[model samples]
Target chain A: MDTIVAILAAAIVAGTPLVFAALGELVTEKAGVLNLGVEGTMLVGAVSGFATAATTGNVWFGVLAGMVAGVLMSGIFAILTLNLMANQVASGLALTLFGVGLSAFMGKPYESVTLAAQAPLEIPLLSQIPVLGPVLFKHQILVYVSWALFAGVSWFLYKSRAGLVLRSIGESPESAHAIGYPVIRIRYLATLFGGAMAGLGGVHLAEFYTPLWVEGMVAGRGWIALALVVFATWRPARVMVGAYLFGGVTIAQFFAQGAGVTITAQFLSSLPYLATIIVLVFISRDMATIRLNAPVSLGRPYRPD
Target chain B: MRTDKRITRRITGLAVGTALGLALSGAAYSQEPVKVGFVYVSPIGDAGWTYQHDQGRKELEKALGAKVTTKAVENVPEGADAERVIREFAAGGYKVVFTTSFGYMNPTIKVAEKFPSTVFMHATGYKSAKNVGVVNARFYEGRYLTGVIAGKMTKSNSAGYVAAFPIPEVVQGINAFAQGMRSVNPKAEVKVIWVNSWFDPGREREAANTLLSQGADIITHHTDSTAVVQAAEEKGKYAFGYHSDMSKYGPKAHLTATTHHWGGYYTKAVQDVMAGKWKTTNVWGGIKEGMIKLAPLNPAVPKDVADLVAAKEKDIAAGKLHPFQGPVKDNEGKERVAAGKTMGDEELSKMDFYVEGVQGKLPKK
Candidate 1:
């Protein structure tokens, strides 16, 4: 039970970055846009956040700077794909390359400088609960923010009238455009939103997860978050579940090692990727579910006639 | 996640095309200012492995003054790309190039085969070519000393070790630490948690926390990140740092650290190259040769314990103390070292057995 609680606590923390990034991508797909630049954008965000945190000595400022930097990165993607009608796949890949290069180039000086790790906020009465309190409530503010984003995204996609229009646009951008909805503008907004969320994920990593910016600190987390979006089939809540599940799989090796399990570290390290592939295979097997949840015009670019 | 960073990583090919023309102008001058290059696997991080190497570069520059010029390119991958970069340095007239990572061994050897005139040095790797030499530190000595202190200070009789991989270097450190602990407190045991990556702070921090929750009061790590020390700080637990002094990251929680000092070796190597006395010799330096130095003991350590560690450090420096001496037993109760014979450097390099008090078995190579 103690091991279970400890693992649960770590899973929540590990999954926070994925939750933010995947939720952002979920919103992007919901608007019929496919942005594959999350990794690059997150790197840019990570460095920018670290620089801001290191310079201003304020983690909050770092977060804000990270979001701004991520938006700037996606803005490049938006101009290329949305404004200039470039192929979404090629443009997204270009954005990732550009953002990653730019981040490493700029983040050279900030490498290895650490930000003070944020403390978990304990809710007064609620945090007094024995196991669950420490596991759930006593987390950095970003964890709660991720949960709130999940809730907000779910509510925004399902209950709001704007969400209805967004869903309709994702179903068929041409049809939505025929109905006078600004499909291109909505896609741009969604892409930028995804960028900002990815930035948050990167910042969460630098400020909370690792609290130090190493070169390549995001370390494929952006790509993992992208995989998480596919596994979730464009659902915000499922993204959270998938994120936490990946977290558990990722940390299980550590737990096994700590408990004196004699497994080789190489194989143990591969378990997370193995688990991801297995879960992705099972999740993708339900083609009907994916087809139902996936946006029909996800990768299709819309030019207003 | 995928190797996205590798795809986007910068190949910082900084070629300072200086007066190679003078050397090529038909005069074979051996004194034409030695050009040195360093291939860094990671950026010169604030205070880690690469950082220490970078510090050595500074020392080399200071010691050599105008006689030697050095250029370093950071974040270079250790596969074919490293071979290419190393060859670029050799072809571009760098007289000596140091490949400062274990992964760069084969590549360094491959590059050396083509440019035998350009001496190559690899760190922590066993393979040595005619032009390629190997150098490493007895980091286990510092680990053992820190373990002794941790053994004396811990109230819970448990110390946590967050390791990067199950490689021999990491395993040796774990065993040496356990040996140090058991020497001081026979009942004390070291718990092992492998983060699997050399520099993942999130995983390192999580592993440290998990170890603390599992009853470890003192923590140390073989990983690159400062997360374990930071985690120790927040948890109010004691910790010993590795690779670099990390007391700044964990002020009160830090007891001491085993830091790497490469300046002395780097300076000597460059001076030898300049003097035309460079050889393909393996250099395994320890506290005696001033390669592995310990950070100052934290004020939290008891005066007697600190004094005891200081005395042992002197013994280690004076060749009076051996951390992996006779009568060493593996965690499985198999006697690896007999009562009379100390473990030699050859066997120590391939160490794959945990000392008697480590919590886990050393993973198979």
Candidate 2:
């Protein structure tokens, strides 16, 4: 029982960043922009956030730094896609390469420095709950904020007027533009938000999870978050489940080694990544379903005739 | 007809001459700075491999004054992109380029051949050319010293090693450490956990915690973060560091760090290059050479414990001791290093297994 509780606790903490990133990407995709720069943007956040937090010894500034870093990188993507009329797919790829190289350069000074990670906040009654207290209520503030962002993104993408237009643009950008909707402006904003959220995910990994700075510390979690979006079927609620599921897989390696089943340990360590590929393959099997649900103008650039 | 044809050819020649003039002027401003470029597989702040290389670069700057100028593009992909960055630096008039990751070996060689005048140095790689040199720190010697301490200090009779990729460097350290541990405490066993990444603090910490929970009281890591030390400290376990001294990360948990000093080599290499004596050659430094040294022992370590570890270090340094000094057997009980026969540099460089009492298999990579 303790092991199960421990695993769940590990899952929530390990998976929080993935949950945050997937939610952000879900919002961006719902608005019809496909930014494949999630990995690059998150790494920028990780390094920038770590530097800021280490220099100031303040967690808030670290998170802000991460958000700003993501926005800045995402803004570059926005300019190429919205203004320069570049192919969205190609621009997103460039954004990733740029983010990765830039973050590595920027993170050079803070390598190996240890700083205080974000501490968990305990709510009075909820914290006293038997198994759920530590699992759900005892996470750092960012974990709770990620859930709030999920709810907020879900409502915005499904219910609000702006949400409707964003969805319509994703469904058919030309039709939305014909009806006087500003497709480019809405996408730029959504892309920036997605990038910011992905950045926050990176900061969470650097600040709260490992709680120290290392170059390439994100270690393809941003890429995992991208996969989580597909696994979640582009739904906010599903994104949360998918993130924790992947997170659970990350924590399971410890349990597997402890169980001592005589498996080569390296293969056990490779489980989460292997699971990611498996999930992607399973989800992509139904081509018709995916095609029907996928954003129509997903990676297409629009130019007025 | 001949006169008309000559007139037409002269007109064409004048047009081509104007284009040639523009191209020559474009090339004139390219030599403003003497560029030095670094291509890295991992980022510099990793506190493990790349961190030491970056320190070497800094040393080059101090040793050469303004004669050297450097630029690095980190996290470069191993193949074609690596060639592009090296060529870009070479074309940009970079006089010297350092490619500091193992995977960058072949790509660096290819680029060095193209830019024959540029000097190139690769870290921990075998491939070399007339203009390229290969250099690697003898980190295993220090690891063997640290192992002596681990063997003496472990109350649980089990020492854990958190490692990066299963490259020869990491593999050698693990094997030497196990050998050193067994030499002192015959009952001790080394358990290794490979994280398969150069620097991921999350994975590093997870690996550390896993080892601690599995009853490893003492730990050492070849990863690029203090996360392992921090994890060890959080669990009140003993640990050793790599690349840089990480005592600061886990002040109480740190036993001794097998610190790699690149400044000595960097300073020497840079000075020779400036003096025009920098012929490309492989430079390997070990315990006696001061390139690899142990960090100061933590106060919590017992005095006798420190003395015992120090005595082993002295023996190795003074040539009275050799970590691989014989009667070594592979996992299958096959004889490897013969008794009383000290392994040579070439042999040590290609070490492939644990010398018995190692609890895990050497990952075939």
Candidate 3:
């Protein structure tokens, strides 16, 4: 039972980055801009968050600092794709390369030094329950905030007027621009919001998850989060499911291995990612469905001629 | 119209010419410096794998004086990033690059091929080349001694190991620790929890908590961080430290650390290179060469127990002791290490099977 709770606890912590990054991408795609720099942005955010926490020893400020770093990186993407009319895919790739180099350089000072990840905020009544207490209520505040962000984002994307406009811009940017909705401005805002969330995800890793900022510590989670955007069909609620599903894949490997199941440990360790690829293949079986749900101008730069 | 076309053609020709010249010059500039670079999976703090390697790099520099210049990029990831960093270092005139991490084997090989003059030394990897050499510390010997301590101290007769990966190095340590423990405490059994990561402290702590909660009084880890020892301390349990003396992390918790003295190996290897006797060979040293040392036993240990371990240590140094001596049995009670014969380096390196008394399964690599 404790093992199950431990697995759930790991799920929330590991899934936090996915929640934030997926939400960020969800917003960016909704605004008609696909920022593939989500991975790079989150990596930079992690380094920035870790750098701050290491220097100041305040975990919250480190989180804010991470968000800012992520937002800044996203701003670069926005400028290239939104203002300069560069190819979104190419720009995102460059962003990833640049972010990897920059974060590696920045993470040099922080290698091997340990820090405290965020502490959990225990609720008096909820935290007293046997297994659920430790699993649900005993997680760091970031876990709660991530779920809140998911609900709030779901409401905004599906139920709000601004979300409607965002979706409209994504579907038909020229028409949105023609209708005087400031398509570029909305994209910029969306990208920034995405960057902030991705940055928060980075901080979740550097400050809340591992508490030690190793180079490449995000370890493709940002990319997984980017994939989660698609796996969830660009919907906030489904995003949660996909994130938790991947989290389950990771956490389950530990439990299965810990339980002394007779298998090569390497295969068990690779199960989460291997399962991801399988899921990706399964989801892509229906081309028409994916096409209909995908943002129309997802990887295309919009230039008002 | 003809003149305009000719001018456009001239501009295109000039652009191609410039691109070619830039590429050629970039290639030529890659051959500078007795350039040495090291790619570390973990950051170089005051101690650890990276720390020890960084220290060796410094030692190399001090030994060679102006003959050698060194610059390192730490915390490099194992895959493509490792290739890129090694290429950048090689391109920037570093002649020798040390890629320290198991996963860096293939990438280091690829980068070495691109820069033929650049020598690459990878730590804990099986692959090697004329330009690339592999070096590893014989840390299992120290683990064996620490296991003896764990064996003596565990009143509960159950010990826990928070292992990083099921790689041969880790598997060897787990088996050796179990072997040593069972040698002393006949009733002791070891339970292992594979965290699947090298340095995730939360996971390390979680693994420690699970082991402690499962009635394991003594714990040891093959992971990078001291988080396990810290976790043990918080729970008021006993545990052994690895790689570095982590008694500082949990003074009350650390029984003894199987500390790795990498500086000796580093200094020797670098000195060989400096003296122009650099030969590509597999170098693995144990207790005698001081590459591996056990940290001081905690004050909580009984003096007689400490004396017994100290005697064993002396025996190890004096060549009167071997961790895997004769008369060993497989888990099935079959004769494994025959009596009157000790296992040599060759047998130990390819130790794919477990010794007797190891309950858990060894993963297929």
Candidate 4:
């Protein structure tokens, strides 16, 4: 029982960052934009958030600072791809390279410096539950915010009127623009949202996950989060599911080792990534489902023509 | 492989360049200050491996303020990029360059060829040349000392190691720790989790927590993150820091750390270059040479156990005690080092066996 609870708790902690980045990318893709710079954006966010928190000692401000940093970084992407209409793929890769180098440069002084560990928030009644209490309720506040973001993203992508237009634009940006929707403006907003969430994911790593600065501490989670979006098929609900699944796989090595399985490190370390590939393959088998779910105008640039 | 050929070509070119340079540099003392360069594989964050080298650089500057000057470029990936940076430094007229990561061995050699007048020092590598020198610390000595402490402190008779790669260096540390554990308690076992990367805080934290949850009371890591020690602190367990003292990061959780002191070496190398006494030399310095030392032990350690560790430390420094002495056996009970024979440096550098008391097989790279 304790083992199960511990694994489940670790799964949540591991997956929360993915949940945010994937969902944000979902919003961007849904609005007919594909920003492949999630990794870079998250890196910038991680350092900015860490620096802000380290200086001000205010957790909330640091988080907000991370979001703003992400937005600013995404804004650079929007200007390049949206204004100049450069190739999105190349631009995104450039952003990743830029973010990696810039963060390293900016974070030089902040190395080995750690923030005070963010305490988990506990629900009053749920905190008393035996095994599930610490597993479920005893998580840093970011976990709850991710859950709320999921619900909010779900509503905005499906239930709301604006979500309807966003979906329509994603389906055919030309048609949406012809029918009087400002496609480019909406895409800019979506891009900004994706960047903001990417920031949160990155900062979550530096602030809450490990709570210390290391060069490239994001450690390819941003790439995994990109995979999570494809695995989720652009649905916010599935993003959470995919995130947790990956999270569980990530912690499974620890579970195996802790359980005294005595597996070789090479074989055990490959399990999480292997599981991710298997899940991606399984999710991608249904071509019709992916075609139906993926935004029609995803990765397409619209210049109001 | 391509780097080797380039380096060879550079060496041939350097011979010609050196004779011309020698004629130009007949003067024993030049008015210009000696310049030293460092290429780091990762950022010189306040902790970890590069930070230690950076500390050495700072000390070098302090020791020879007017005689020498230093410059460093951090986050240099050890690949073609490393060659580019090293070449740039050599071209920039840095008289001595320190390539501070194992991965930078070939690049340092390649760069050293172009400028025979420049001296090169590569850390944790075996290859050396006319102008290149190999230098390493006996980190396993410190690991053995930490293992002794962990073995004594273990409440569950199990310790955990969070390792970076399956390289010989990391494998040696794990094996040495295991040896230390079994030396104290044959019942104790060491479980290891390899994270592959040198500095992934999230994975390190996850591995540390998993180790704690599984029953390890004491955890150590070869990774370049404070996450392992920090994880121990959060879980109210014990941990040992690496490369540098990390007690401040996990004050209560930290026991003793294995720290590298390169300041003395860095200053000596600079002084050697300035005095025209530099030569290609292999320096395998350990506790005896004061290259490797332990952080202050946590007060939580029992007095007798601490005293025992201190004595073992002294023995190691004085060359009276060897971490990999004879009678050592592999995890499978096959004897690797026979009685009366201590394991040699070459054997230790290529260590592939998990010593007895380790829970898993050595991962083949």
Candidate 5:
């Protein structure tokens, strides 16, 4: 019972970053701009956040810096693909390569530095609930923030007037433009929002998750988040489920090894990626639903003449 | 017709310019500083594997001064990118290159063949060539001493190890640590978790937490991150840092660390190359050669335990104590080493089994 609670708690912690990044990407794709630079954006956010937190002794300041850095990084992608009319795939790839190199160079000074670990905020009374309290309530603030992000993103996408405009822009930018909606501007906003969320994901990693700065520390989580966005069919709720599922599988594998499971460590280590994809694929198999959820112009650059 | 004549004339002028430049460079060769290059698999962060190698590079720079100039490229991936970087160093007139990481073994050897005049040194690998040599420190020697400390300090009698891969080097550390722990406290056991990555702080932290939840009061990791130590610190548990001294990351929770010092070895290697005495050799130095040293024990450790560890460290350095000494048996109850015999380097390099006191099965390839 204790082990199950511990595994669930760990899954939430691990999945928080993915939730933030994937949700942000979901919005970006929904606005018809596929920002593949999620990895690079997260890296910049992570380094900047860690560096700020280390210097200011304020983790919140670090969070702000990370989000801003992420915005600026994605802003580059937005300009290249949206304004300059460059290829989206090429621009996104360049952003990732640039982010990897840039973060390494920027984080050189902070490599040896250490940060104080932030304690989780346990809700009074509510945390007394058996199993669920420890698994859900006992987590760092970012985990709660991620839950809020899921709720806010869901409401923003389905129940709001702006969401219809954004989704319409994603499905057919030309039609949306003909209807007098500012298509490119909405995409730029969506891309920047994605950048901010991706940055927060990185901040969660450098400040809250591991609380240290190391080059390539994002370590393909951004790519995983991007995959989650697609596999979840760009639905915000599914993205949340997929992220937690991946995190759960990752923690469970480690527990399995501790329990003397005879599975190869290599295979066990890969279980998270495999399990998340399989589960998400099985649930989202209906072709019509996938078509309805997927943004038609996701990776297409829009030029308003 | 006019353009053709101009192009031909330009080619002649460029050839003459190249010839004069080469002649000038040849004249200035002896007076120029010896160019040295270093390739690192991870960022030279404050602690862990690459940082220690970077420290050695700094020591080399300070020792040689103006006689040698060095360049270190950090966070270089261990495959095709490594080859390109190594070749660039050689092509850019670097006389000596140090490729620090086990994954660079094949790439170093391949690059050495193309750049015959350049000296290549790789770390923690078995392969070698006429121009490529390997240098590795016996890190397991320090691990055994730390295990002794963990064995003494832990109330739970279970130590958690977060390992990167099931490679021989990592396997040796796990087995040595188990042996040392059980030598002092027979009831003590080790639980192993493989993250399968040399550096991933998030996963490392999760693994450490899981180990702690499972009643492992002490923890250590083979991965290249301070996450385990930091995790132990946060959880109020003890931890042993690897690759470098990481007490600062977990001052309260850190017991001690098994640190690798490549400064002396690096300085000597540079000196050998300068003196034209460089050779392709597999140099595995340990406590005796000052390549591996135990970090100062935490004050929380009892005086008697510290003293015992100190004595054991000396025994290891003096060639009296072997981490893989006689009477060793695999977890499956199979005799790995006879009672009177110690494991040899050849067998040690191919180690694949977990010794007694390690609670999990060794993951197969």
Candidate 6:
């Protein structure tokens, strides 16, 4: 039972970064823009966040720097795809390549540098509950912030008036534009938000998850998060579930190996990716639901004459 | 017309004089610096495998100064990109090219064949050609010593190893560590977890934590990050660092480390190439050759344990002690080495099984 709790706690910790990145991408797609540069944005975020925290000795400043870096990265994507009418797919790929090289170059000086471990924030009274308290309440501040982000994103996307306009624009940008909605501007905002979220996720990895700066340290988490957004069928709640499910599988595989399971390590290592895809595919099998959730105008370059 | 001819002749004379003077100066300083190139599989992050090789490159530069020039290209992937980088160095007139990763073995050989005049040195690889030589350190020697420390310090009598892959190099470290642990405390056991990546800190940390939660009070890793050491520090568990001294990453948790020093060997290889006496020998150096050294033990280690490790290290250096000495047995109770025999390099290179005291079966390919 204790081991299960430990695994759950670990899953939450691992899933928080993915939650941020996928949710951010979902918002961007909802605005009819497909910014596939989440990987690159996250890389920039990880380095800038780490560099700031290392120099300033303040982690919050690092977090701010990461988000800003991510925003700036996505802003380039916005200008290219939105203003210049460049192919969104090509631009996103370029962004990832650019981010990979840029982060490695920027992170050269800060390699192997360690930071003070981020302590878990225990919620008073609530943290005293038996198994749930330890699993849910005892996590780094960023983990809790990820939950808040989910709540805010859910409210913003479904419960708010602006969300309806955003959805309409995603479904039919032409109709929305005809109705006097600022299509390009709204997309720019959504893409920028996605970049910020990706950056925050990167910062979470560098500052809170590993607490060290290394080149390519964000690894392929950005790509995983991007996949999470899709496999969740573009729903905010499903994204959260997919992220935690992925994280849970990852930790469970390691635990299985430690417990002397004879499964091949290579297969076990790939289990997280496999499990997440399988579970998400099974849940979102209805064609109608997928079509309804997917933004119709996603990845289309929008230029207002 | 006569004056024009005279002026042109004077201009030609001046140009020739300058050319002759420049040629004379170049001849006087005939010894051009030897160009050395390094191809790394990963970035030379502050510590780890690539960083140590980079350190060796720095040593070569400092030692030779004006007589040598060195260039290192880091983060070269292992396949086609590695071949391209190696070929580039050879074609660019680098006299000595060092490919510092096991995956670069085939590419190094292929490039060496194309540039027969250039000398190529590949690290941790067995393949060698007329121009391609191999060099590796017996890191298992140092692992055994660190294992001794872990065996003594662990209150739970079980240790954890976060490994990158099931390659022979990593497998040797795990087996030697278990052997060293059991040599002192027979009840001590080791649990192995392979993260399947050389430098993913997030996964490495997760593996370390999983090991710690599974009742392992001491931990170590063969991956290219300090994540395991840092995890041990955070969890208040013991950890042994690999490739470099990671005491700084885990001031309290680090018991010691098994560090690799390629500086001395790299210097010798370059010097041999410069003298045109380099051979196609596979060099595997250990404690005696100053290729592997144990990092200083933590102050918390018991005095008796530290002294015992020091004595054992001396025995290893003097060829009186072997990590895989007599009576070695596989975890399956198979006799790997007879009571009076020791495992040789050939057997060690193909190691794929766990030795006694290690918990879990080796994940088969």
Best model per DockQ: 6
i-RMS values of the candidates, in order?
1.7, 2.9, 3.5, 1.7, 1.1, 1.1
- Candidate 6 has a DockQ of 0.68
Candidate 1 lDDT by residue in tens digits, B1-365: 35765544432222222345554653655546688999999878788899889998999899888788899988898899998899999999998999999999999988899898998999999999888899999999999999899889888898899998788888889988998888899999998987768867778887898889889999999988788998899889999988888888989998999999998899898888777899998999999999999998898999999888889989988888899888998888899999977899989988888889998767676
Residue A38 displacement in candidate 5 (angstroms) = 0.8
lDDT of each: 0.86, 0.81, 0.79, 0.88, 0.92, 0.92
- Judge candidate 3 against the unseen true structure and give its global Cα lDDT, from 0 to 1: 0.79
**Model 5 C-alpha lDDT per residue in residues A55-84, reported as the tens digit of each score:** 999999999999999999999999999999
Model 6 Cα lDDT, one tens digit per residue, B1-365: 99999999999999999999999989865688988999998888788898889999999899888989999999899999999999999999899999999999988988898899999999989889999999999999999998888888888999999999898899999999999999999999999999998878889999999999999999999998999999999998889899999999999999899999999998999999999899997999999999999888899998999899989999999999999998999989998999988999999999989999888889876
Writing each residue's lDDT as its tens digit, candidate 1 over A1-305 gives 77887888889899899888889988988888888999988888888988998999988899999999888888888889889999988988888888878887898887657677687898888888889887888889989998889889999999999888989998998889998999888888888999999999999988777787776677788888888888778877777778888898777677887778887777887888788767766766788888999999888888888
RMSD, each candidate, Å? 9.5, 7.5, 9.5, 7.6, 5.2, 2.8
Chain B TM-scores of the candidates:
0.91, 0.85, 0.84, 0.91, 0.92, 0.93
Per-residue lDDT tens digits of candidate 2, residues B258-293?
887776777676567656799989988788877788
Show where candidate 1 strays beyond 4 Å: A276-285, B1-31
Displacement of the residue B236 alpha carbon in candidate 5, Å: 0.5
Could you say which candidate leads in TM-score?
Answer: 6
Chain A TM-score of model 2 comes to 0.93
Model 6 earns a TM-score of: 0.96
Chain A TM-score (model 5):
0.99
Cα lDDT tens digits, model 4, A119-187, are: 889989997899889888999999999999999999888899999998898899888899999988998
* All candidates in order of TM-score, best leading: 6, 5, 4, 1, 3, 2
Clashing pairs in 1: none
How far off is residue B355 in model 6, in Å? 0.5
Q: DockQ: which is higher, 5 or 6?
A: 6
Write the number of the candidate with greater lDDT, choosing between 2 and 5. Answer: 5
Evaluated against the true chain A, what TM-score does chain A of model 6 have? 0.99
